[model samples]
Target: MTALTAEGLVLRGWEPGDAAALVEIYRDPAMLRWTRFPVTTAAEAEVWVANQQEGWAANTRHSFAVLDDERLVGCVALKRGIEVGYWTAAHARGRDVASRAVRALTAWAIGNGVTTLELRHQVDNEASCRVAEKSGFRLRETLPATPPWPLPGHLHLRTG
Candidate 1:
């Protein structure tokens, strides 16, 4: 997939130079709170980036580096059939970066034959819900106390 840009953010593939910024973004506490995943080490960050590269190589996933004015702010991806993993740097939140990124990805999904796009967020993440709505994904239902990964979250869908 080619790079896409919208709303002052560029979404493109990972690069070796993006490791440092990506590590910091993933280690940010807000991302941990929102996504319930922790990345505390540079090594873990490298592994994650490598896995992303592998996913791209294998065609199992499409990843992008969220860049704002030449700086890597975060990363987003469409993984495993319209499941989007979006995490922005703590500093990038509240500015609608994730919303813009998701919007571009959703348009691309529709172009690529995706019938439905799913967004799952922790029940407590109001900011995420707002993004989903702004990107045109309607809330479908609340999955009560699911398992392993935070329960009682919401499921939103965008169908065309």
Candidate 2:
């Protein structure tokens, strides 16, 4: 994936060396709760990074590390040209990192011919709901809590 710069932040592909930084970010309970795949140990983090690389190669998923002045602050991803998700570390909360990263990714995806995008989060996660709205996605429906999603969720959509 191409590196993107926006609003004093950089969104770039995950690299092998990024595993260590990701380990630090995933230490937060919020990350563990929100993410499907949690990267707790160095080995898990490495495998996560490798999976991201493979996703990029397959053109099926695209993930970017959200950087602020070269420091890792968050992450964003576009999967299957439809679904989008993002997270901001505890240190970066309230700084609008998630919205900015998602917007940047959304713009790139649209430019590459993606007509619509989707964002979903547990209904209890008001913060993620806000991020989805701030990133220009509108709530489309309520999803029943499924096995992967522990709680009922909101589905947000953005169409180009």
Top TM-score prediction, candidate number: 2
In terms of TM-score, how similar is model 1 to the real structure?
Answer: 0.92
List of clashing residue pairs for candidate 2: none
Mind giving the per-residue lDDT tens digits that candidate 2 earns over 71-122?
9999899988799978898998999998899999999999999999999889
Candidate 1, superposed: residue stretches over 4 Å from native: none
Local distance difference test, candidate 2: 0.91
- How far in Å is the alpha carbon of 31 misplaced in model 2? 0.9
lDDT of 1 by residue, 1-160 (tens): 5699978899998876677776677666677666645666777677777887888889888889888999887778888968877877888777899899999989888888999999998788888899899999999999887666565888999996
Where is the poorest 10-residue window by lDDT in model 1?
31-40
lDDT of every model, 2 decimals: 0.83, 0.91
C-alpha TM-score for every candidate: 0.92, 0.97
